[model samples]
Target: MLRSPKDPLSFDSREKIALFIDGANLYGTAKTLGFDIDYRRLLEEFKSRGYLLRAYYYTALVEDQEYSSIRPLIDWLDYNGYKVVTKPVKEFVDQTGRRKVKGNMDIELAVDAMEAVEHVDHFVLFSGDGDFRSLVEAIQRRGRKVSVVSTLTTQPPMIADDLRRQADHFIELAHLESRIGRDPGERAARAAERQDRFARDADPEDI
Candidate 1:
């Protein structure tokens, strides 16, 4: 059941909404929650909640690799109504002689959110990073409601307290599992599903 608008976690169906997903952070949070997100379902679920203006997904690609595991997902999102933002991954060696990969999309996401504030009534941020506290505050100052989606049921908790405090709403990702999650078996069947679906959807005229 939906809560009253006075509730901290309630969303108004008439307000325009946009989703800002931190690709890596969301993946980690969902993995900890023990489910795979059916992105197509996620889009529909949010669209049902309100007027979904746009969904932005951010990630870093390892361009050096001939095959990146996330490439297929990125491609799928690009074709399926998501505004996908990406950059090349930076490889470096640390002071301790350990290899490291740097790929943070915070600045990109913040800029987009700021620009989107003029049009969106509410912002749904899919990340637990405390670094976004200031960003959330800034958005709120512009009169847009901000919802932080992350989990608090884990051992150490996935959400940053300061970030959660700054948000107008806290949407527990775990609670949304039934609405957005895909069965783990889907992965095992994906290859076959892809082949069959492709053959069925492909047209000879297009080919």
Candidate 2:
């Protein structure tokens, strides 16, 4: 039997894989590397490598704001085959009376990963947060292969040494730039295509 070019990707016998993208972390990593993520291409590249079970993207939103900076990206991902998880940003004043916002999605991400362990054969994590070291170890103990995607190419590496060491396999994001990064030429076209398209932040990864 021959498989046609139009055959559904799910019909393949490849290992089942799930992607867990820490939105803020990924944005920062890519920013440091000087490129934007072509999320469509990222999903396509992974789908080509396996039977993609799910692609999860986690982020935090400031509900008080009339319009969020990342709203367009979140909406796009939700409509384009991604399971988007979001929570409101928590704002509080510190001991110094300085106001700060906290929106770590670590717990949400961990709980989701654990729940998905039974259904997936491989887990691909896209974040450098050291806190996930334990989560990776836990997932590995459940007999699933875990791949951590982050970069060590920067002056100060984006990935944590502990998390990198804990993963079954470490994939350097820098290596996948050409495959998943958005094209520089497309920036103008994309901007013109949609006024709602979100622009990336110049600051480091947060929330």
Candidate 3:
């Protein structure tokens, strides 16, 4: 059974809520649990709790690529209800002479969350980065409830202990699979579509 609004972990139907999704982080977490998030279901799940003020999705895009694997999902989110924030990935050579791509959206997420404090009564962050612990505490101090969504069911645990402890509520993503996970058949269909696109885009001689 779901807890009542009186519970610190539960939401009051009247409160204003906003979702901040760390796209890469969330994708990695869900993949570890062998599931894919159904964004439409995710939005509905929260909208049922309160007035959903906004659903923000943050990601880093490789601008140099002619076609990015994540472009389709980003476009879908933009067309849907999500507020997508994207930045270009920075590529650099590491000390060991290995190429690496860096695109951390922590600052952007934090800034947006802080800006929402005046309008939102609840903040739902979809990332387990321990770095957000301080941000969670700050939001709580501002008198807004903060819920951190991530999973601790994996071998190494996807959530940081500090972040989980700091949040007013810690929602394990594994527990939400049934509510927001994509159906296996639907996932297969999407996968096949992506493969077909890839095939069509490839050079005929390479096929």
Question: What's the TM-score of every candidate structure?
Answer: 0.86, 0.84, 0.88
Off by over 4 Å in 3: 1-9, 193-207
For each candidate, the alpha-carbon lDDT, in order, equals: 0.90, 0.87, 0.91
Total colliding residue pairs, candidate 1: 0
- What global local distance difference test value does model 1 have? 0.90
Q: Hey, what RMSD does candidate 1 come out at?
A: 6.2
Residue 188, candidate 1: Cα error in Å is 2.7
- lDDT (tens digit, per residue) of candidate 2 on 47-102: 98889999999999876888887998999999999999999986889999998888
All candidates in order of lDDT, best leading: 3, 1, 2
Error of 2 at 105 (Å): 0.4
Query: Between candidates 1 and 3, which one is better according to lDDT?
Result: 3
- Which window of 10 residues has the lowest lDDT sum in candidate 3? 1-10
What is the C-alpha local distance difference test score of candidate 3?
Answer: 0.91
Total clashing pairs for each candidate: 0, 0, 0
Instruction: Tell me the spans in candidate 1 whose CA falls farther than 4 Å from its real position.
Output: 1-9, 191-207
